[model samples]
Target: MNIRKKVIFSFVILVAFIISISSLSMITTYHMKENSSFAKQVSRLINIQEDMNELINLVTIENSLEKLKNIKEKFISFENDFELLREDITKKDHKDLIDYILPNIRQNQNISKSLNNLFENEHAIELIFDDIYKFQNKHIYHNDLFSKIYPEENEKRKLLQELIFKTTNLKLIQEFGNLRYYSKETLYQHRDMETFQKWTNSIDEIILELRKNDRLKILPLFTGYKETVEIMGNLAINIHNIEKEEKILTTKLIKILKENRDESSSIEIKIEEVAEQFLSKISFIELILVITIILITIALTLYISSKLTSIIQKLNSGVKRLKDGDYSSTIVIKEDKEFSEIATTFNNMAQNIEEHQNTLEEKIKLRTNELQGALVNIQKQKDILENLSNKLAKYLSPQLFESIFSGKQDVQIESKRKYLTVFFSDIKGFTDITDSVETETLTEILNEYLDIMSTVAIKHGGTIDKYIGDSIMVFFGDPLSNGKAQDAISCMNMAIQMKEEMSKLRIKWQKDGISKPFHIRMGINSGYCTVGNFGSKNRLDYTIIGGVVNLASRLESNARPDQILISSETYTLIKDTIKCTKKEELQIKGIAHPIQTYEVISSGNNSTIIEEQTGFNLILDLNQIDKNNIINILKNTIIDVEKNI
Candidate 1:
């Protein structure tokens, strides 16, 4: 696991150890309290039983009422002590202990009370019996004396003895409820009352037998003897009831003690089990804690020591190797830690030093080789430069080549919107001419024609843009220009000169075994166009683009062979310097409006079209035609036409 989980696990184990110890302690404490409580309650019960036994002894021995009262008071004290202890008992180790013990305590108290009542009833019976016995003895003594004085009274004395014998035998009657009450069986209904009434009738019968017509009936003590017997019968009934109640209470007390013993025994067993479990848990916790501490100590020590020592040793070895000039040696310590970073840095340092050494060696060798190769490379470059120079001169005008090579033109990729006179021309019917001419003758004628046109274009400072098969695209007013008027004039001059040159080339081609005539169409438009080195960085073309270029191409496409068409914009710029004829407005694609164009009839004092068509004989200042119409034109025209016609 990761460090976080390991730490949490360690913390959990420690907490569990503490909890185990605490739980053992709590278990021990609870049992201790429970044992103390059970012992106290049992002791109270034993003490109560002992006190009750003492009270029973007193009833059987001294039978003193005061002694009985004191013994009963001691039992009450036991009950009070039990109550107080019950209050003190808070921990319920055996949750049902009170439920099990309380009724028993109550029963024991009832038994004590029953025993006390039994003693009282038995004592009263004894007193009554004693009085009856004493009265019987005195009557016997008087009977014996009277029997000696009159032998005939002996029958009455014998009857008296028999009656006394029967009355005394009443004590031998066993109670019916005694066996039933102890066994929790139902008692005969009203058994005590029945026994009481039967006992009272027996005493009445004995007294009646003594009172039958006899000479001894006149004795004054005989009435007291009868009253004593009646009292003794009542006392006997009370004694029997009390004895029956005592037996029941004794049974309940025994049952209570038995149940108390069982419950206490159960609680003791449970406490023993808890103690055993606590001990086992404590032992296990101790074992785990010991093992965990030992393992963790060893593990942490090894981890920290091995990590720190191994990484440091690797680093030290790397440093020693570096000192020994083994700069190429690398330190590799594989671990998921910061040591990996240190090793990486060490490796990089070693690599840098090694690279520095290798670089120094390489630089020395390169310097030597460069010196040796310089002469041969110089001669080789001279030949290559001469060939490139010839090729560049063939493709570019001297002015364009100078501008670029001298750094006057940077040749960066950029475009500018400028009003430039764009020129386009193509040889008409060159494909058919090529079809009719031999390849060698065709090449000679094409080259001768291009060379002538290029010379004329360069003379007028026109930039030769490119050649498309038999077509030529050139532009002026860039790289060098006097003004718009001058640039337009130069472009028109170039077009006219190229047309004149093509006329001579056509005648020359025919003379040199050529069959067909070659003609050229030229189109020129002056407007805003974007001009720049337009292409990828590796290969660029100094070119122009925009609607103006397209319009120029369209003008070229529309021009008849041997005709040079120019837009109105160019026409206006060089109208005074070059002559032109206004043609129909031509519709060109990509242009919103029709273009006003003119045919270049001639250039520079070549054209003359100043005659007016209207009939007139007035002295007209025709220079005003180049300016505006004179006001006398209408009157002169009417009279002169009428006279001259």
Candidate 2:
């Protein structure tokens, strides 16, 4: 048969095995549950057996009517427990046991009720002693009065005294009290009818002797004594009867419990034996079925494995031939079984691969030459793009140019609020210089000066915003910053360096025959300003704007030539790193309040200008040396030099 039919047949057998195993498991589970339930019932019966034995003990040990009352409640509770037990006992053997135990339990309950009623009606056994004591006291009182009336030591008085201190009567009265019962146990201990008869006879003898004393008969106290003794005799006999009944019932209850215990043990053993036998049967059946399934599964696997091994070997031989460039090879299918379709498809694929091989080789040859030319063109385009990027860098500040090329900042018309230290500086007499000098010469000077200042600003990490005429605007704290304080300090240092550079340029210009060279005024301010690329998308300028920029420009206009002025905001930031003198507050345009200002001075690393020439050499740091002594010292040195010349 083909593989599909074989697989379908194998599935049918597996499903059959599954159904068989499941049915067996279900049956085993049902039987186990049955056995477990039977065990629980037996467990409950054993507990009832224990309770019944305990009830027998309660009846046997408890004889007092007061204690018997408590036992009466115990009897009721036991009855309740037994009734519940009876309902739960579904097993035939256990139910039979319950049937037997029920009648005996009822008998015990009746006995407890009888004991309770006996004490309730009879004022208990202590009343006998009380009656006897009252009779004895009356006899003593009357005997003494009779002896006083006669005043004679006679036989009659002697007999009356004999009755007063009667030993026989005292023994009868205190019998139960001496036994420490005086209640239910009084009758229990002396349960024999002979004991009651003895008590009665002793009372009869006392009355008989009292009748013999004619003088005592006339005494009212003597009559009362006789009647009291008679009442106690009756009370003792009645209490004895109640106690006898309790003992009989208790003995019967004990006998019944012993029988029930034996039955409980037998049932427990029988149930266990039955359970063991059932489990053994189930295990044996399951073992046989499991072995059958395993043997069948092994045979099925071997059949499929043998068929698969032969098919795979044949397919592998065909694949090896095809791999060795044997396109003419074809698989010869036998049995029309597994892998026949795969053999047909593999043959078709081999034919197609042979057909396309020549065309693929031709295409690869042509693509090789084409790819080389494209690579050369790609390299040329890359160099051209890099050169163009460098030219674009000239228009933007170095920081801004780097951000745009590095993909950190997007070139868009976007702006954000940032705290920047804005700087503005212009040549002191730029308009005069433009008119006095030739256009070519003036343009050269201006370019040279701008180049110097631009280098200083860029070196201090400022973004050169724009150059208006000879005026240059720059800002710090933009695309990147070392915080506001550092940005402000760097700007102040840049301004100071620019001022010093101007002094050097002045000397250079004098040598160039241009007597009055340019001086520059600079201003710096720190505050929140709008900074980013501003303008249309086609033409954008990465610069800053707002009131802080305007204030910086105003400070520059108000500054004196060769001076660097700054706002109070910038002063605070540069105070630690650079020396700045707080200046007078000035009211400027577009500002409601007076603007506080400061003059920039030397920094921590201030340098003195050292000028050396053919005729003069001057090295003076005004901040470091004594200025008052310098003028006379220079004069004396000049006079000595003049004599030598």
Candidate 3:
């Protein structure tokens, strides 16, 4: 057969095997379910057996009407459980097994009812005996009282008490109570009828004695004594009759229980036999079918493998020749049309391989020139990237530069409104200090200050937006944000660290022969502001602008020397984390309202309150602070202020 027919035949055989396995599994499942049902019924039967035994026990321990009532309730529950099990039997074999057990269940129910009757009758007999005993005791008391009142007949009263004690059947109730029965067999063998009859005879003898003795009748209490004897004797006979009936009923109940026990045993045996028979039959067939399927599968596998291997070997041989550079010859297969087409394709591939070999040198030369051109372009791009990287490092933070270079952030002058923590700090009395320092020393001091502040900003993940002469502007929560609160906290921490570093720088500058050292003041604010690259097409500035930014600058301009001032917005975000004292409000320019500020005290160190209250408002045109000649102008202002005072 061709490959298609071979594959089809193999598939058909596999499908047949799967169907066989499925059919076997279904048959096994059916038998398993049948066995499970049988087991369930047996389990229920066992429970009923335990209940019956418990009933017998209840009767033994209690000889009262109440215990008998409890026995009826328990028996009803047992019947319900058995009925449920019977309804659960759905399989034919399981139903047949239950058919045998159900009859016994019914019989057991009847037996339980009969036992209940026996218990009731026993209770009634005990009650009557109790009443007779109580009456006998009352009569003896009256007799004694009569004898005491009439002293002449005291000896006769004593003899009457003896006769009464000897004839009473009160002690017979103890014998009835001793009728021990703990199981069905014990109940069956008990001599209850004989015991009741002997009790009746003893009472009859007492009644005969009472009738024959005339002396007993002549006593003053003779009528009462005779009435008591008659009542006791009658109750004894009634108990004896009831005893006979209870014995008969108990015997029948025991008979039914035994039959039920036997029937239960038979059903269990039948279930075992049925389960064993079904399993053995199914297992035998399963084994045979499995062996047959294995054999068929192996035969088909060998047949298909042989056919496929022949074509594969031919194709493999041609592949090996191609691998060995034999491009002049091709393989030809004749077994099947499919193999023939493969051979044809293989031959065409060999012709193409030969033609490709002829132009291989020219292709290599062309590829070499292309690779050289790519290398030259790569070198030029590398040089351009190096220059760009160096320039970016000076202008942007390493993180922001990487983001822009990696194409994650664009270089376009696009801006967006975001909440950022803006920081502004400047050297206190910078102009006054600059006047005492040389130009070169001042340049050195300024560069050192900028470098130190910038280092702290980058370390705290802040972006240094710009430097305005002796002032620095930095903001966080842009391009990447650790959240607004975190950014504000980080900015505050950076400001604290910069203050500490500046103290050391001041000491170094003083040691380098500078007489006056400048202290830094910082201001921070956290609020919504527009931040991005914004400028002309030729030049762009990545900075933030808004009222919030202005507020930060105003806080810096108004801050006391060596103090860090934060706007209310920044203080609100870091209030729980940073310790700060509220500062007086400042009326900032270009704003409608006076802004609330807080001086960050004891955040990291002792931040002094150096800016004193002037008691009078001193308004100065801040525009007079020139970028180029701020020191000379600031000195002139100090002289003019002294003159005004």
Top-down lDDT ranking:
2, 3, 1
**What's model 1's lDDT at 452?**
85
Which segments of candidate 2 are over 4 A away from where they belong? 1-307, 337-341, 357-378, 406-419, 430-445, 479-485, 507-518, 526-537, 545-551, 572-577, 582-597, 604-645
Q: How well does candidate 3 score on lDDT at residue 7?
A: 79
For model 3, residues 157-267, the per-residue Cα lDDT tens digits are 355445455444454333222321111112233324454444334444444544565434434454444344333334434444445544554565565556555555655
Error of 1 at 299 (Å): 99
Q: Over 4 Å off in model 3, which ranges?
A: 1-323, 326-355, 372-376, 379-383, 406-408, 604-645
- Clashes (backbone N, CA, C under 3 Å), per candidate, total 0, 0, 0
Candidate 1, backbone clash total: 0
Hey, what RMSD does candidate 3 come out at?
35.5
Clashing residue pairs in candidate 3 are none
TM-score of 1: 0.36
Task: Please provide, for model 1 over 233-336, each residue's C-alpha lDDT reduced to its tens digit, 9 standing for 90 to 100.
Answer: 34444444544544554455455445545544554455455445545645766677668766776776576566567778988999999999998788888743
Q: Per-candidate RMSD vs. true structure?
A: 58.1, 42.0, 35.5
